[model samples]
Target: MKEANITDRQKKENAIEKIGEFHRFGSILGLERMNELMKRLGNPEKELKCIHVAGTNGKGSVCRFIYSALLANGYSVGIYTSPYLTVFNERIELDGEYISDSDLAAYTDEVLEKVSQMTEEGFASPTEFEVITAIAFLYFARKGCDYAVMEVGLGGRGDSTNIIEKPLACVITSISYDHTDRLGNTLAEIAREKAGIIKPGAPVIMNVDTDEAKREIA
Candidate 1:
């Protein structure tokens, strides 16, 4: 890989700058629209084994931990996180590497094309998050990743990552009442939704525990 005359740090900074312009988190949080968007890209997420992770917090750190471990273990890992710390591509990494600028540009162009068509088809334009999420899936699939660690950008029950079916693993972190207004105010209700990621027979890992926390879902 010839250096693009820019240091790795500079490239990361540039990527972040480019990603900041993509702000689609405000779009509708429904499967119907995301499904259509993914279809436009040929549903790249379906090609890999998904490790669906959900929680009220600690989701990003957990994603990072899983990504690091996978990298150490020699698996090609695709990580999908929210609200990139910098570049949008940072939210979607493959084997600890980000998709190249050219790749991201191409992916972003595809997303914009889909969004324009969707709007013409009477669907509300995708939110910044949706566009980027779609891009992540496409980038991962293009790289031929083996496993994808997905972190819910919002509540698990309706998150875009929930689009996956029968993921190899479903992991949930400590559930809390932070998103009460959107996920429920009570501990049990919130716990139930967070635990929604625990598909039947799928392995569930949790650092959250207890016999008397008012919520035993974890």
Candidate 2:
């Protein structure tokens, strides 16, 4: 038992270190690298039904509500959120349980192979958030989740999570003056970025208080 526990700890530590390497790339908000990476991985994000949530605030709460509701209704739900308060595994969950360390390491290894291929092929390396998003998609798809609630890491328009072609629903929560440098200085600008997640046919649910933001999204 002691030997097995040590092995598991080593795997988790190695996986976390490898993933942390991409942090040097910072938050590059674009889908080009993510699209290529997903294609190389067989496009796992397309296999699962997704609910894409975006906004400056309340994204985590909204995602939790949706995930819990889905689970209560006997659905196998995958929850993907950002900026985990504690462990890295907290960012990915299925049916309220965090992803296992073994699964995280296995999926991280798979994604690392594809990322290396991308680099060898002259494609840019994916950012840290992008890599994590890819791992979550693979986990949710392989686990055969009925629904996946995805929280946007940054602005919705070009966020790695935006690689999802079509989601079951697009949700824009309370938008505020946040990420002004990256998103925009005004509410309308931020709203436009968040609105990018709204696909042509996907139903949208929003909770913006500002008319300027609402008009842009509407």
Give the per-residue lDDT digits (tens) of candidate 2, residues 1-218: 88987887789889999999999999998899999999999999989999999988899999999999999999999999988998989999998899988899999999999999999989999999999999999999999999999999998999999988889999999889989999999999999999999998999999999999999998
TM-score versus the correct structure, for each prediction: 0.83, 0.98
Whole-model lDDT, model 2 = 0.94
Cα deviation of 42 in candidate 2 (Å)? 0.3
The lDDT values for all models are 0.75, 0.94
Q: Give a tens-digit lDDT track for model 1, residues 41-155.
A: 8888889788888877789999899989988998999998877676556777888687766677677777778877988999766666777788888888888888999988877
Model 1, total clashes:
7
Number of the top lDDT candidate: 2
Top candidate by TM-score: 2
Q: For candidate 1, what is the lDDT?
A: 0.75
Q: Looking at model 1, which ten-residue stretch has the lowest summed lDDT? A: 209-218
